[model samples]
Target: MITHPKPQELTEAVARWIEEIRPSLDPRNAFLARVAANALAAVTRELTMGEQAQAAAVERLEALLGHGGTYAALNWELCEELRAGQMDTATPGLLMALRANVLDQLAIDQPTYRHEAS
Candidate 1:
């Protein structure tokens, strides 16, 4: 009989593996670093924006439809409703926002700002 690792254990192991490899990988693999950075930034943004987006949606609804109006009250669900009711189509804005937010986070986490010599 084979025993599988628990979900938390698996996650922890993966985290450890990443931590061990990230240093060498960062130097040797710019593409990998960029991809990893983007991914990390994206997840961070989504997790961070999830709440802010919900709040912004609710606020917009409240402004237009009275304070009681909300996704639940408007017969819509969370992310989908917000997606349907954003400025412009949500796809472009969302993708752009996600990338921008992630890039910002990447900058914050590992700033690479440089000044050109005059």
Candidate 2:
């Protein structure tokens, strides 16, 4: 039996390829290649970390929204609540949950991003 490359593995490979050749390209092309590599890395992170991040987000949404459902559904409800002024920092766990969810997304989208806590 043969094992196929995992989605994350493919993304990582592509990212590595881009990084390896980025320096040999023209200045503009090198910049683009770096951007492409960053995108591929984010894709890899999503494949590797999205599930756990989503589950944690779902849990936070459930507690904050007071109900359970699919990640999309719960997230929508949470957004609506926040927009309707039903949730705020005064709401217990709201700030922490939001911060964690955002941080998780940043972990995938921009691992080098820095966050300063208030």
TM-score of each: 0.32, 0.90
- Over 29-85, each residue of candidate 1 has an lDDT whose tens digit, in order, gives 855755565555445444544556555555554544335665567425334556667
Best by lDDT: 2
The C-alpha RMSD of each candidate to the native structure, in angstroms, is 10.0, 2.1
TM-score winner: 2
User: Cα lDDT of all candidates, in order?
Assistant: 0.51, 0.87
Give a tens-digit lDDT track for model 2, residues 8-82: 888889899888888799999999999899899889999889999999989888888888899999888888888
Off-target runs (Cα >4 Å) in candidate 1 are 1-29, 65-118
TM-score of 2: 0.90
Residue 20 local lDDT, model 1: 60
